[model samples]
Every structure is written in structure tokens, then in C-alpha cells.
Target chain A: MASSNTEPVIIVEGLTARYGEVTILQDVSFEVYRGERFMILGGSGCGKSTLLKHMIGLIKPHAGRVVIDGVDITRADEETLHRVRSRIGVLFQADALFGSMSLAENVSLPLAEYTDLPPELIREIVRMKLGLVNLAGYDNHMPSELSGGMRKRAGLARAMALDPTFLFYDEPWAGLDPVTAAELDILIRSLNEGIGTTMVFVTQELASIFSLGQRVIMLHKDVKGIIARGTPQELRETSSDPRVNHFFNRQAD
Target chain B: MPEMNHRGYRLHVEGAPGAQAAVRLEGRLALEDLKALMADLQAVPVKMKPREIAVDVAGVEYLDSAGAMALIEMENLSRSLGIPFELLGVSEKDHGLLCLIDREALQRPPLRPESERPAIVVRLGEVARRQYRDVLEIMTFVGELVAALAYCLVHPRSIRWEEVKFYMKRAGADGLPIVALISLLLGLIMAFMSSLQLKQFGANLYVANLVTIAMVRELGPIMTAILVAGRSGSAFAAEIGTMVVNDEVNALVTMGFDPIRFLAVPKVLAAMVVVPILTVYADFFAILGGLIVGITGLDLTAFTYIQQTKSSIRVFDFATSLVKAVVFAMLISGIGCQRGFQVRGGAEGVGMSTTSAVVSAIFLIIVADSAFAIMLHYVRH
Candidate 1:
């Protein structure tokens, strides 16, 4: 639906990553369309997180370019990269909140840095962001004082502080229980619909893939590239690749 | 289209004076000029004190969360001023953002204010209790270390020689240059200063006696101990403290490894073995330094100086210096491991432990040296 008229929001062209003599990912290419939910699923050590990092320009590829919002972040100048980065947000797996700052301070940091808004407006925006994540009235809690699920939600609030057009999540459900993770999944879905923001999720959670993924790419360790690319339903119902089938059906092998 | 600034904001008021007024806002209502926007909204109710104010935002191009919140704040201000107010031309996207903010949540008070600082007497008492607990913890750690060392003594094959070797290279070999440099300079300064007085008495040869006696007994061992404390002692604390912070130490314990024996013993053994050897090297470099001063500054032959140094130092002096070196090594390594084990919290805790390791090691080294000096004086007499 987002083809032709509007350009793709992200373009990862001919990406290759190597660690010493070992090739982790080779000649991987993909495009994320505007306002679509894209999922990257792979087995452990299959380079899911590595690919996500490359897509976000956190780790430079041995050979490739990642263009976000038409700016090639891989080769962009600092000012251009910063401008490109301002339109996107990333939620790391470890919930990298500043241990020294309170939850409100963590959420307000981007607003204070990037905007010329008054302190009162920034404060209200922080409240709205936190409230969006169901973390209302917890502005004074330190990151150390919060539970794991709470910290993850707080991290999400901080990521959404600038209302970025693109959101990238790295294993958002890795450490949560089923109920909490399901709640988080629902929250992500609501935010996606409400904000109409493009999202790229790197996860192995089949439930999340089925529930939220509009498009999916499966990375394979042996092949060192994407093995299957399609919608989650198509991959689950029609894919002939044994690896893709094994992953979707939760097979042991 | 109305005129707008570079930030894309404009405010227009219509209706004659003292008549019902309509306020029109146009262009991008975004975070960039929110401060000025807020000032404009505040001026709306004051300037006209209008009986009714209608805010129209249909011409607004963009509305961020801050922009939405600013409009809400304006509505609240108008309500408090008892002026009838209404918002017009709310776009679908803007209305969604406005609905997302929970107004009651914003009005809720913070959970609690920051706690006030305690009284001086209470803070002093807390510090005293903390120091007391620190002493008790040190004693317990010393006991555990002794037990682990005794176990290793009984089963020498059980000692981790690999770790011992690794630490030896770090604490001993890597520390040689600084130890050599500082002791050499110390010996040169001592000899030169003592030579001035000795030259007055025309006893330049005795400068060798003074330098040899001082270097072998006090300066050589103490200077080497201080350097080792600064180099390896802080390193030991920081390394182990970071492990504690990362839960690596806890993992080792959960896997049935005695953290003291597994982590501390090798570093302690390495320091004890290398520090005494380093002190001997320190003594040699210091004497060489005294020989340089004697030849260049004191007009004494190397052979004469060497002969005086040899006669001045007995086997008793070497034994005493080695004893001091070994004891200082134990203190440095022991306090370092103890402080590291006591670490809590995060990276700040590791930093605090590292600094405490160096300062405490130097202090204890000087204290022990004083005790040795007094005890050795009576024994020599």
C-alpha cells in the first residue's frame, strides 16, 4: 500500500558484517516501507540484533549503506546524521535508562536537548509520554527502584519523547513474563496505530511476530543472509523453507 | 493566508474593543516557539479581559504534544479567570494527541519530596557506625583470607598458578620502571642533602654510610611499597569491584567457588612474591644513585664509596628490609581485596573502592613501618 508514491523510510543496501575471519552477515539488503510494522526474526546467534544495529547506524557495516529518511546515515556528516537521527527512536534491550536520573528526568532529556520548549511544556509532555506507557504518577521513581517491566516501559517513554517518525525495538520481550509481555505488545500496537509511526522490531517471540508483524524477514545463521521474506501469515502458512517453517511452528530443530 | 514568522506562528485578534473577541492561531504550533506562544496566550486574558474568548486553531499546520498541552493550559487559565472560553477547529490528529493526555494525572502531586539532610550529630553518628562496620568487615575478610591461604598451603597443587603468573606480570614486571625511577631519585636527593652537612665536617666518605643505611633500612622498602600500592593495589580493587558490580563474583559463588580463594589468593600471593624482589631491586638502584652523587658531587671514588656502603650494611639490615617489604605487600593486597569485596551499588562503588585501596594501603604501610622502626631500634640496642 505504501509503494511508489512515497519513498521507503529505511533502505539497507548490500550490508555485510565480518568479525575477524568469520562472516556474520553477508550482502544483506532490505527496505522498510513507510508506516509499516517490520519484524526481523532469527534464532539465537543468527545476527538479528547485529542487523538491527546496522540498520540504526549504531554499528558500521564492513560494506553497505543504511539510508534513513533519504539521508545515507552510513556516510552522512555529523549534522546530517543528527538531523536524520532526530526523526527516529531506538529502544535497547537492556533498557538503558540513566541510573542517576529519575524517570521524569530521563523522559524529558530529549525534549530539553532538541526543543526550545518551556520547562512547563516539557514537564507536561513528559507526563503525557509516561502516561502513554501506563506509568503515570511514577515520575519520581529511580530506574533502580523500578521493576524490569516498569524499566522497559520507562525506556519506551523516553524513546517516544520526541515523537519520532520511526521506532526501532531490539528484543523488547526478551525478559518479560507472558502477561507483561502481552501487555507490552498491546501497548506497542496501540502506539503504532495511534501515532502512525514506522516501526522495526527485532524479536524471536513468535506471538509478537504473529500479532504485530505486517511484514517479516527471517535471517539464517548458516546462509549468513535473509532466508525468507514475506508477511508473517504468508511465512507461517505457505513458506517451503524448512528453517522458516521450523521457526514459525516453534519446532525444536 | 496570514503572515507568519520563521517559526511559523501567528496570533490574530478580531472584534471591536469591549466586544466579544475571537483569537485566531495559525501556522505550525510546535515545541520550537512554545515559550513565546505561552506568553501570547497569557496576554490574551489580561489585555481585553474579554467577556468571551474563542481560540481557533484550524489554520495550524502541525501540532506536537507540547503544542497540545499549551492549548490545554490556555483553556485552564481562561477558566480560572472566569472568562467563558471555547476551543474551535480541532483537527483529527490534534484531537487524538489532546485526548491522549490525562489531565488528572498531571494534577496529581509527586509521590514524595526529596528527604532533607540529617542533623550534624546524626551524620557524625552515622559516619562512626559506618567506620566501625568497615573495621569489623575488614577483620572478617582477614580471617577468611587466612583460612584460604592455609588451605592453599596444605594443597599447593590446588593453587591457581596461572592466575598467580598473570598477576605477577601485572603487579611486578609492569611496576619495575616506576619503582626503579622513584627510588633512584629518592636516593640521589638523600645523598646530596646529607653530603652538604658531611662536606662541612670534611666527612664526604660518610655520605656513603648515610645513603646506604637510609636506603636499605627505610627509603628503599617504603618507596617501593608506596609505588606498588599505587599501581597494583588500586588495580586489584577496581578489577574485583567491577566483577562484583557485574554479578560475576556472585556467579562464581553460586557455582560453589570460594570468591576469596578464587579471586584474592592469587593476587595476594603474586604481590607477596614480587614486592620483596622489587624492594631488593629498589635498594640496588638507590645505591647506584648514591654512587653517582658520591662521584660527581662529593669528590669520592666509586671504590671508596662502595667499600663504605658495604661496611655500613650488614646481613641484619637486608633481613629487616625484606621483612618490611613482605609485610607491606600483605597489607596492600589484603586491604585491596577486602575493599573490593565490600563494594556495592554500581560503577561509583568500584571507583570508591579503588581509591580507598590506595589511600588505606599507604597509610597502613607507614604505620607498620613506624612500629618496625621502634621495635627494631630496641632489638638492635
Candidate 2:
């Protein structure tokens, strides 16, 4: 991993997002520094997913800017935006694997499309990526045949195909059992440590946030912006806000 | 800082006695440049190899997973030749991503070649078995639909009257203008063609008889059925397929409601009611088309043409066609609903089911029409 630098890889300034008449997020500003595991935490219906989408340039915010690697993605031209996007990878909540394709084919898609490599080499890379997720030799299986946790793992393998410097995960362990969820957490932490890739993860799982997140921001539906920001241990021990306390303590508020 | 470029990837090799060989890499190291990198590395002789190889990556502007794998593969090759390999000057970002690559998996032998093709007989047998199973499944679906209909008849209040009305408007009322226009054009074409043959025999007066019989007995019912199959059959399949994919059908089952009754019944009933009505309109327009030819080509009056058509057609002819229309409607909507319920996977599944619904409905309609024609022919004789 790169040494912890003062320079941030991503800068979101006064971002306000809306869908038609309904406002989703307002004035959401944050800087994601290089080599940090940044976690976005919130309850259901909060704008965590919306904020992630804005960061990846999937959805444009109604106001303000998101600067990624020195380029303002909000105002970048299609070509420039595409160049920026090539450096980042996202795993959606649904896994969103192409259902018709086998696991190997799914993982090989980005490499095949973007590079002029021999088919033999691409096939080898696909195997290595799948192996990273502990899915070796399951390449020929269709996405529909995999269990939910396995499917999510396959999705992660596909996301890592390009070896993106920045990775964003949306609820990586949402539907998995406790054991599988913990296994996924361990995999994520190892990947962060071993590869030193910058990660921005959106999750409501308190256990995962506490264990894996280096820095955390809690979004609230009522405020439509971040209400708490700190290291997970700091928030748990020193935060004065009742909601933050309630969250860390697992109280029904 | 000596500049070196080879196949879009710059490589500078430095070797000294009793020292590790330093290979400086620059430019973008990605999948596109893998072939050149592999060839260049292979060109180095194994006899002169040192104990360790230092790969300097500081000048490399960009590196992806493929590039990482290339380095790993090179490392494995060096180890095989009794040499240790190490990467030097890797940026923090590149190092992080490169570490995620599982070196053990990368060193595995290339994937086995695809399996051999199956024998022709085996392939044919498999297809036949699949089609047979599909037929059995459709038969079971029809039986379930009939049971649901029987239940609805016994309990009149169970029918979803609102959905029936909605489908009737969509499949019947909304379909009216297009159906009428197409039927009218068909009638005009039939009258115009037959009039030419009749006129050659100086028998233009018989045009009314030919047009009336042809439209009522065959064209009117068959054309109406085909139009409805294309319009509403595909819609039923697509709608139900989407519901199946969305798990709405499963939800209905869990809620103690029969999916066939709640979804398919209304569509079937609406088509059954509306298709016959459209056939009658088609028959009327056909007779009018024949009358136009009679007035213009045969120098006959409107009164004369009407009298000829009325004398030539019987009530049995109209009743037979209407009966055919009703049966066609049932087949179209039933097959559509069945195909929808068969959908699996995702959006592509829905699309496939929709296309199959129209094709199967049309095929069944034509087959049923042939059976009706053969039975009617024997009875008439």
C-alpha cells in the first residue's frame, strides 16, 4: 500500500443530489485520502447508495462537484469521465453479474473489452482473479448456479479484473450468513492490507464498520447529509452525539 | 535515464558480475503490452541468469492486474530456471493491487481445451427429450388453468372484474382501429383479385358469393386470430414473465392466491369475448369490399350485390367462423400465459418468453384451424 499521504484521491464539495422533486442528499462534502479504508454507514433509506453513485459518476448531483484524482467527474466530458472511471471499480448490492454468462466469462469481460491480450493470457488472468476470491475451478458455473455469497464473491472478482486503484463496495455482506459475512470481511481486510488499494465501502453492518473501516461517516435520512465522521474506535468511545452512541451501542432509536 | 522503447513498453536490462540483473520498466504496463513483454523476457538466456533479478517499475506510468500477472508469470519462469525474481520501485498503489493477485493460481497450467462435440444422435435425442418435457409441462399448465376456471364459475365473486375490464380495453377496444383497418385492406385485396378471374369467365356476378364465403369461413377468423396473437399474446407473455422475474408470482402464491386464476383468467376471458366481435366486423367489411367491386367492375347496383351475398351465405357459416375465433383466442392467451410462467433468469428470459409466446400461439392457431377445416369438410360431405 502507498504510504498515507496528505493528498486525497477523491474530493466531494457541497454535493446536493435529487430525483425530480425529492431531495436525496444535500451539501455532502468529504475527502477520501489515499490508501484509507473509508466506510459510509447509514440506516436503510439514507442516501449512502446515492452518494456512492455520485462519486462514481453514475448519477450526477443536482449541485456541487466530485473531484476524483484531480479531475472533476461532475463536469468532465464523456471521454475524460470514461478515463477516470477506468481506474475505479464498483460492486453493487445486487452483485449485478451478467446472469447469462459463466463466472469466468463475467470476470473476463472488462479485460477482453479494454485490452488486446491473447485469449490464453486473459483466461489465465480470469483464473487468478477468481482464485483471489477463493473461487478457483468454479469458472465454468453460471451465475445463477452460485449461492448468494458465492455470487457476491464472483462479482467482486469481476470488479478486481482491472486491478483498479480505487474500489467501492455496496453492502458486500448484505445477504450472507454470519459466517459467510465474517469471511467476506476478512477477505476485504486482507485485500486492503496486502494490495494497499484505496476502498470506499457503503454498509449498515456495524460489526464490519468497526472491524474493517479506518475512517467512517454516518449519513442520516432526516438530515440528508453526514452527521458523524471519525475513526470507528473514536466514535464508539468519545462521540457525544446520541444517535452516534445509539448506533455504536446498538440501541433502537 | 537512457530512453528504451520496445512494442510500446520500455525495458532496459542492466547486468554486472556477482550482482543481480536490474530490468527497468517504463510506460503503460497492461494487457495490451503483455505479448511483447513475454517475448522479451523469454529471449534472455538461462545459462547467464544471475541468482536474483531486480525489476524496477518506478518509470511505469500505469499498471493493471494483467501487468501484475505478467510479472508473476515472469517470476515463475525465472524460478524454474534456478533464479529468484523481485520487483523494485513499485508505487504504493500498484503494489497494493499487485499483492491481490494469487501467485499460486497464476502458475497453474493453461485451461484445458473445450470439450469435444457430442454425437449427432445424442444431440438429437436430447433435443427431442427437452421438447417432450416442454409439451408435458404445457399440458399440466392447461389442466391447472381449466381447474381455476371451473372454480371461478362455481364462485362468481372470485373473478377479478377490474383486471378483466382493463385487459378488455387493451386487448379488445384499443386493438379495434388497427384490426378494422387491416381486415378492410385484406377484404379489398381479395375482392379485387377474384374479380379479375371472374370477369375473364364473364361471371363477375359470382364475385359476391366467393368473397362472402371466403371471408366468413376462413380469412376473417384466421386473420383476426393472427392479429390478436401478435398484439396481445406477446403482451401477456412479457407482462407475466416480468412478474415471474420480479417474484410477484411467488408472492401471489405465498398470499394464498392461485397465480393462474389471478393473472391468466382475466386475459383469456377478455380475448374470448373480444375476438369474435372483431371477426364479425371483418366479415361485414369483406362483403362491402365485394360490393364495391360489383358496382364498379360488373356494372351491378348495390341492391343486386347485397341480394347475391345474402343468398350465398348461411347462418352456419357465420357460426362456424365465430366458434373458430373463440378457440383461437383461448389458444393464443393460454399459450402466452404458459410461456410467461415458464420464464427463468432475468430480462433476457422475459424477452425469450415473449417471442416464443407469439410463435407458439400462431403455430397452434394454424394447426387448430386445419383440424377444424378437415372435420367440417367431412361433416358437410
Best by DockQ: 1
Best by TM-score: 1
- Runs of candidate 1 with Cα error greater than 4 angstroms are A1-6, A116-124, B1-3, B13-23, B46-48, B51-53, B83-85, B192-201
Residue-level lDDT of model 1, residues A152-217, one tens digit each, is: 999999998888889999999989999999999888977776566789999999988888898889
Model 2 per-residue lDDT tens digits across residues B12-70: 87775346777888887876677777766644425446657888999988776667777
DockQ of 1: 0.46
Which lDDT tens digits does candidate 2 get at residues A123-223? 88889888889887777888888899999999999988877778999998898999999989888887777665689999989888877888889999899
Runs of candidate 2 with Cα error greater than 4 angstroms are A1-3, B1-3, B6-9, B15-22, B26-32, B45-64, B81-99, B107-116, B195-211, B284-312
- List TM-score (chain A only) for every prediction: 0.96, 0.96
Fnat per candidate, as a fraction, reads 0.36, 0.43
- State which candidate has the highest lDDT: 1
Candidate 2 docking classification = acceptable
Residue A121: error of model 2 in Å?
Answer: 1.8
What lDDT does model 2 reach? Answer: 0.86
